[model samples]
Target: MRRLLWLTAAALLAAGCSAAPGGEAAADKQPAPRPLGGVLHHTAAEAAALHRAEEREVRECMASRGFEYSAVPVGDGVRRRAAGNPYGLLTRAVAAQDGYGLTVERLQRHPADPNAQRVSALAEGDRRGWEAALKGTRDGPREEIELPDGPTVSVPTDACATVARRALYGASWDRDRYTVHSLADTIVRETLGHTLVRAAEREWAACMRDEGYRYEHRKDPLEELEKRLDTAGSDPAALRTNGREELRIAVRDAACQVEAGLAEQVSRAQEQVEKALPPARTSRLEEFRAAREGALRRAGARAASTT
Candidate 1:
């Protein structure tokens, strides 16, 4: 789900970079700003200290990259997350803080280590190396805009700001629409299963008729019972079991329909989000979606056919 959300976010950000209504006016009067760099520091600190450090790093990294940068919280949830799991969560939070995507690895030739401390160091070094490599590569264009400090490195057009916005503003809408669709699909599948049960009962009646049980039009219970007994044992459990089986069959069929409907909705939602991403990032996300769809389809089909 997180991956799907991220894919959608990338698409939203990458949508045709129409000039922000006020951005053009600012752009015409200013020089194109330099690109910015960012770093995530996850050391223990007081709230005041942490805030200062974050702001400082944003400033320093931007300066190093020849652009002026300012720190902006991507969402209000960040502080809450930080408050909840200060130590344990920082690792992942810092890892994706830059937010273009996972840092790609260019494996280095490092000596193998058997010592635990040495192995830990090696792992840390690898993680840092990958982050540096990602920061060095071209994630997208350097978008410029007005800032308090003259022409600063405006947040990239394809930034987490829009990604977070899309999830917040549009996710509920998407879910609501998908829910309506799922309910409608579930009902249709359930109705079809009921039809199957009715058909099976009709077939059973025809079979009984073939066995020469007369009194098909008999209104008397005694007459109907006499004819039924002449054909076969009148076990009430048989009909009850048949009804239970019918219900189970209905549930199975309904579940399959629901699964397929969900997968299709997710796929379309993912595509819509992808349209917002930068072309290169968009292409990468598309490849991921295709692979995901293939896996989901196989799983859904297998589950539907089983039992």
Candidate 2:
């Protein structure tokens, strides 16, 4: 679900240029300072580096096994992927350039995976070998890990993906995945639903209505946009029109987020909510965070080496 009710954030962030709601005292101040540190924390730069490193690992591994793989750039396909947290804080540059980033995603020429073309082009047996090598034998001792929220997920010990994680996140990669994968949204929801954030939502909703978008909840416009997009189908002109409309709605949403201090509210609430979690979960979160930072460092090094 859209980042699990971070409202439009189920999608992100804000830097609104319009006049803010508060008077001179508020106007004199900048946006509220946000807190740092969470179970889910990765700046866009770190994320991009990690993405590149992981893709390189998988690609190189598959090549060693006599298969072709092309690392896809970060896109919508990756955004909602399990175990990823791209729910970036909104900024003015972000809103003006990308809105919620979906329009750019929608307009892309490639699918979620560039390698889909290669896989489709392969002979059946070759394709099976490729899949097996990348994912490993599903029935053997090395199967996917089971989690609280979903069915068993494969991070097959024998697979390229698992190898990539190991290289980037060290031996605790599996444990790290287990800790953070299912809880990303859970954490996001708790933070967003905190009292402070709830109040901020009310103000944001009011601001949206004032802007002529009657969205009681932040995700409303996105939901509406999706439904409207369904009617557009594949007509180029229709898609372009919808894209433009999406940008319009998103720009306003970003502005409203700023006027309401939603981003700051969520960040602060997240810090508080995380502090209140049970000790066991808290420990696991700490472990996950350590792994993430380690991975970022490794990924950055790899990126530099390649350059």
Candidate 3:
């Protein structure tokens, strides 16, 4: 059984800059638009006010873009648990990405600005909850499932693989949504990661050259190992085993360097974004993407060997 793993990026739109809450002058109190997209405010009072303004702006923005919107109030019971809880609303719009179909969902009011630690924590909690529910449902006998045989093969159609893929993509989208402030912001974050990673690597190479360090930057260790295995096809198993271990070590080293680089970049980027954004919703989209790419690379290497 071959597993088909498909992921579709969600089409997001900045609901628009919102105001927390105010009566007649609410429109005048709207927070300044941040460079990243929506406005972020610190205090619940501010967030509430901005939230209201955003609700109105988002509706207008959608209408200008030819979409409809409505408001949904969270009951008092649930609102109390949420600090400075502001009423949430849903927006429905026809966008090119949705094939011009009706799209409706309540925009989330995240607790704080997008931070890597917060994003990862949220993803882990979600994954744990999902696993717990799955465990509760599986009270029957256990059976061993077989995986496909190959150097790099597709996911299996087995139940286990299906579950794994769902889990993986769920986490992927969860992280994506967490970092994404708006649809435009998501696109920019994704594009920036691809461009920045290459640019940063190039910069690192330049730094090495200036320092006279004879370091070679291999694009993908797994590919390099695969090539060596092809040459030693008669002893493929041995070559593959060796290659897998070496790849793991290489990945660990690469991951460490990437982590350090990401830390610095995230800090710098966050600072820059915050300067232009309010305290509530500035995003850590770029950092999230960097981490996602690193995980995908590691997962790919593991899949190649396991298959």
Candidate 4:
């Protein structure tokens, strides 16, 4: 069955960056922006503000449509609970302990969801209607978005969530809205293609070979580990064996990343990529940033009013 929009496992991570589930801000003051590689990221406070504003808009829209919608507030611990670097840029010591960090992710406990409880309490027919209201009819109008590195996905155009997203970001937002949240593979592609970065990567590969691991690309280690893990599923003995091997490979991979200067070169390549972005792409990114800031302001105002 099509689950309710913004419910399920996603709620644990989506519920908060700095605010609890209601319209209230978790922190009184907004936090500064964070950096991802060279890109600017919203601080937890800013994320919570935007989420608080978006969810409130969703709730109001649902109420107008004669449905009960609960606003899932961003909890301060949402992203904080997850351990390990998603990018796999681990230090030698940490890598020796956590491996590709997938083990920690596998064992991470999920938080409770009020929305799930709400949905569970509803009649089957009512649940379907509720999902359709919040997420739109399955066969309804959808806007197709092409991700930089992923398959195209269709987003409901007229759902309460869509309405809220447009209200917060801008009616003109579609692709830009996706770029704000999804991976921008465009930059990664360009960065990796840089002559210097490629050379550094070759060196990293050689370093790996020297350490008794042969991989042509940086992602190979995790991909290989994941296949072994898939085969080891639900088998304690196999998992333990794999886990031990993973730590050894991870430690070497991480040390090689630093020793080969791949990390440094990638940083340099990213800076170059950021500077050399085509005017059109640069314009789009700037527009997205403006939309983000505009929503943050609205969120701030919304939080202030509730207080």
Candidate 5:
């Protein structure tokens, strides 16, 4: 999927550059911002609702096949799994305390689903059959959907995931929007890799050094903390020490970012990319929004009907 999207973006940029004035050099100079908070095909609430509807379908599908199942509510944990500072703006409060949230334990741990445990207790052959029914075969037949002027992507149609998606988004909805969202993500990644952003990162690194920390990039502090945690292993004392050092470094990193104006520079570059996207890409974005809204409405209706 990643390779295909990159190829699509590359093709679009190549075509766009040849037709535009000054070619690739001028196009590279243009500012392109990645979507703020990442490209969400569905909002958290919408996704959660869709998941609930899907879970219900899975339960019914299993029961009809002579197996019991339970529907679990997809709540905060599922929705906020990818929550992070996508905009490069880290608040002082967040940095001073959480420090990338490596040390902080999750407050809402997901309890084991009883239905899964019940499934596990079944006879080996029956359990395998139930699992296959719910998840479909790993090497099963697949349905391929192609993007407009892009590569074709395949997905399993005989799984619970597909059932839920079809109920909420209708057939081919995933394929239609996949390219649009993936292309937007590629633009953001390219924007971050811009020379101007790299220069700003150097300035940020310099500020971190002045604060008595040697780091090359904005993500270095968290990366260092992750390494330390891995080395600490099961040692509580070492973990605590590492956690404290991480908080201190994180606070300094956020302060340095402000002093060096790194966030502002990155944001500016992103805005340029957002403004410079070709009309076709922009149209796809609009289509993405409409598809999302329509899916949400359909998902809501399905959920309400089940109740």
Candidate 6:
């Protein structure tokens, strides 16, 4: 969803130069502002809780229709690790430790969700029916549901997925709240593309070049590392070798970001956008936050009752 209003603690620390050793504060560094906290957005934990609630509803809905279903628990470790680096900030300390997180090896070992595997193991005819029931009609004319706002959203009304969402988010959930959240996030990203931020990115790229790495943007180093990881796949020796290389590159990348002041520049740009946002946009953000909180509360209560 759109996530413009908050910066993770890691992002905040990195941007403020508080997380890195020997990092100098830029002369024009704006005052680092704290994020709006729980009021402005849902935490990763809250999102995962809501997802689990939805899965539970889907499983129950399928069971009531005489099909077996399972609610696969979400991986807390993955969520925690991802939230820690939401903006892909690769500090020297983090690089020395994780090195792109063994994502490729983990995925190779567990290619499909356990719940999905259970569904797939059913007889072909039964599987077809279960899939159709869960996902709605496969070959029907598409339909659109309009939200209270002036926007139309599409969903498969005939699918069990729709039922799951309705159960968790109420019958009137048209995803308008999420749409607004997405818009706010887009504003931050677009602001980062402004001239001043782009100049900082160029300087960061040059710094990386001097360190013997060819990268154009702050995200490029991680992206390239991921590609290498994917190529290494499940081979233990290859993974270890590639992972070490990734750590070295990531450490250099983080150093360059600090040296070129990219984090500070991006943070300032984001702050400017947040301050200059129009009243209408701000109103939508509040609405989104309220809706998210209500959904999470309901989901948590439902989960508690079921247990």
Each model's backbone clash number: 8, 4, 18, 6, 5, 3
lDDT digits (tens) for residues 1-39 of candidate 6: 001111222243343334345553232132322233224
Q: How far does residue 68 in candidate 6 sit from its true spot (Å)?
A: 2.0
Candidate lDDT values, in order: 0.31, 0.66, 0.33, 0.66, 0.63, 0.61
* Predicted model with the maximum TM-score: 2
Q: Candidate 1: give the clashing pairs.
A: 11-273, 11-274, 11-276, 11-277, 12-276, 14-276, 14-277, 15-276
Clash pairs for candidate 2: 2-10, 3-10, 13-90, 14-90
lDDT of 3 by residue, 1-307 (tens): 0001000212112121122123212322333222233222133333343233334433344344332344223222232222211111101111111211111111123344222343355567664443333232244333332212212222322222233333333334333433443533533344335444345555544544444443345234335544554565545355434433432333232333343343234334434444554433434455545444444554444445646
Lowest lDDT 10-residue stretch of candidate 2: 1-10
lDDT of 4 by residue, 118-235 (tens): 8878999988887888899879999888865577978898899998989987875777866644544666667678887789889989999998888999889888988887898867
Error of 2 at 114 (Å): 5.9
Better of 3 and 5 by lDDT: 5
> Which sections of candidate 6 miss by over 4 Å?
1-44, 84-88, 92-94, 101-108, 115-118, 121-124, 139-153, 172-174, 181-185, 230-233, 274-283
* TM-score preference between candidates 1 and 6, better one: 6
Q: Cα miss at 135, model 5 (Å)?
A: 1.8
TM-scores, in order shown?
A: 0.15, 0.75, 0.23, 0.68, 0.72, 0.71
Instruction: Report how far residue 42 has shifted in candidate 3, in Å.
Output: 28
Cα lDDT for residue 153, candidate 2: 68
Distance from true location, Cα of 299 in model 5, Å = 5.0
Cα lDDT for residue 123, candidate 5: 96
Error of 1 at 184 (Å): 44
